[model samples]
Target chain A: MSEAALLVESLAYEYPDGNLALHDVSLRIERGERVALLGPNGSGKTTLVKHLNGILAGNSGSVSVDGVRVDLQNKDSLRRIRSSVGVVFQDPDDQLFMPTVREDVAFGPFNMGARGEELDLVVKDALERVGMWELRDRPPHHLSFGQRRRVAVATVLSMSPKILVLDEPSSNLDPASRRELADILRGLDITLLMVTHDLPYALELCERSLVLAGGHVVADSRTREILRDTDLLSRHRLELPLGFRVD
Target chain B: MIRPNEDPLKHPISDHHHGHDFGERLVLHRHSIVHHLEPQVKILAMFLFIIVCVATPIHFWQAFVVYGLLVLGTILIAQLPLNVVARRSLIELPFVFFAIMMPIFGSGERVEVLGVSLSRLGIESGASILVKGTFGVLCAVCLSATTPAREILRGLERLRLPNLLVQIVSFMIRYVNVVSDEMARMKIARLSRGFEAQGVRSWRFLANVAGALFIRSYERGERVYLAMLSRGYSGKLPDTGHGSAGIRQWAQGLLLPVLALLVLAMTNIWMSR
Candidate 1:
């Protein structure tokens, strides 16, 4: 396997209210590997991912992206790390905050100190990558939910992050849109860490899966192996579709 | 949840075939000469006009006439309709009416107008106050109608307004429509469920709605901040690609402000003599 692109060592996090969200969690993702963080609701998956970009600091332990430590003191480094790991949040409404689509996509490049033709190029290239060039002038609020989600991804992609972190990439999507999203993810070679409750989606897109239960890495195995373990899935409140065959 | 017909998330229906342009239907015609002027110029011109109008004594009929003419000229030059200005200006008219009443209630000479006894100085000052306030309101309306909100914000930023205030205004303008739509949908949902509160007790229902909206907005804010950070948003907002005004553009923008100031200065000199 390629050297670990991300390393989290004994990561522990507690909410301000003294609720322990993550406890002694440790995982490492290899370069160019797509890792699905499978979990039930409130399983600390988000808290763990948030640490990747230094959005939330772990109460104990450390997160290192590409071997560089992520912390508050190295904020400039954190900014670079954040740009390197583009996060597409679950909610497109939250992601696409600008009045127009082009503006929203341009936001990232502009923040990265891209100006003049360089910024224009970044925006154009990113929009084209997601096949949203035609909808560049449209306001994001006016787009269909799927389109907005694609634009949301494009907004982060504009920054040219090495790792694309997505939260619930397929939630609330129509089947066609979900398939489209899956296809989009499959085509991209970037290291992907997707947090999802969609078991089938996780199986299809990721070769490896890590199941988190009670803030601990309970299962780490190949996608097929995890899917085949029916008893293990039910224990964590996760299940496969009835009568569904795994290829 | 995807209610295509009743989707609160649906974009406002666009009438593409009618040749209805976003700027053309509105008083704010994009790309017009007035529209392209620097924001500071527009702001300064408006300020000078308001100050001159307000400074003039209430009995100076000529001064009010000049101010009205200047406002009318501004509207014509902006190519905005009078009706639009009149309707929007009403936002502050009630407040101005209350202020103007001060003169009527002040202790001074009593007079009769159309056989109704009224304070003479009160009547005079009230008329003057009304004209001053009306001129100020007109000037402000013209600023908004001719200039797009984005440009106005840029102008505010250029004029050294508090950065926090400018950012707050920009965010408010961008999100106000979305928030309003959310409120409208909430109202519809409430109505469908047979919501009815007829008295002071209704305030609690309103408060609940407000609280719910606040929570939703706050959650939305958290998500937005995360999205920003994901895209490498530091503390500062990125520039919108509208750089500083060019020399020629700057000169062109200064033209109107200089003319307005000159006219005001001349009027002040004449009035003082």
Candidate 2:
């Protein structure tokens, strides 16, 4: 196989208050792979994804993205790394921060110094990708929650990152919106690490799954294998949705 | 596990339409002259008037009257309901009123007024202060009611107000109501639990609530900042170009206020001499 897009060696993190968030984690993601980080509440799924973009420094282990080590010494490299890895935060309210949808989408490109027509093109393209081109003028506060979430995705997509990290991509989406998100995710060619509790969604979009429990990766295997293992899921405090049956 | 359909936190204050007529609340008619002026003109005029009012000595009673007439004329010309301005001004008046009362309690010459012995110097200084503060507050209320908050920030931006300050104010204006709504819901929850602050120990609960609110706000701010950064928000704010207070609008807006202030100043000068 080609070189891994991201490689983590014994990654660990502990909060200043002495709460261990992640412990001795090692994972490797190949280019263009779609993986789901599955865990119950407080499982350090978010902490691991944050390290992918250099947003948070790992306490012990090193994280390298496509051979570039994410470290504090290279401020310019960190910006470039963050730009290369688009993180769509779980909360739309947290992701869609601009007054208008168009501006919010334009923000990432603009920060990377894209200006004038180039920036406009990026904004329009990204908004169109999420089917939010028409709502470009509407304030995010006025949009439905699902629409806002789509705009949040557009905000990062405009940056054209090589890796897309989505936290709880389907948490608050309605059926129609979730389907739309799935379609969008399936169409994208970039490597993706989606952290979510939605088991069915993971099965539909991600081929591989990493199960985290108490800040440790308890199980990592093919998505179908992990889902079929009822005993492993119970140990990790994850349950299949009611009426969900795998034949 | 709570089914997706049955998340209690999703609908904390369920049925927002139950009693509140949000549509009616939003469609308030503010016909005040300040409202009609282009936002930029109103912002500039208000700023200038506030500066003059604040800088003028308390003993400059005539200047205060001119400022009052200018404000009152703007209110009448804008055709905004007087009751709205009066009601909104109350929020600001209490603080000034409290400050104005200090001179009354301080040592001063004794005098009789309405069969009560009061300090003559105290009343004089206090009355002057009351007049200065009232006109200032009225001007602010009229300006706010006339210009929508977003447009006000835009106007400030056009007036060359620091972008950071205007952006901060814009964010506050947009989010303060949201934060307040959250606090109100929290208060309702606390009330439903029969929690009441009775003593120092009870204040600990209040402190905890405050701490929780602060943490929530801080986390929200981080998310907001990240969102902003994601959207190409560098250090500078975007130029939306909605605030266009041109020369004609500026002329129309300033004419009456300037004329009134001029007439008042002349009358005051004549009276003083």
Task: Tell me the spans in candidate 1 whose CA falls farther than 4 Å from its real position.
Answer: A98-100, A134-139, A239-245, B1-31, B38-40, B96-106, B241-243, B246-257, B268-273
**Native-to-model Cα distance after best TM-score fit, residue B141 in candidate 1, in Å:** 2.7
Best by TM-score: 1
Residue-by-residue lDDT tens digits, candidate 1, B2-100: 222342222232232111223223345656666767776777657755766666666556656666776787788778878878876776656576666
**Top-DockQ candidate index:** 1
- Candidate 2 segments whose C-alpha is farther than 4 A from its true place: A1-5, A16-20, A30-32, A133-140, A174-177, A187-189, A214-221, B1-40, B53-69, B76-79, B92-127, B155-171, B199-201, B222-245, B249-257, B268-273
Share of true Cα-Cα contacts across chains kept by each model: 0.72, 0.34
Worst 10 residues of 1 chain B by lDDT: B15-24
DockQ of predictions, in order shown: 0.57, 0.30
Best by lDDT: 1
How much lDDT does candidate 1 score? 0.77
Compared with the true structure, what per-residue lDDT tens digits does model 2 show for residues B72-97? 87778767678877876665556566
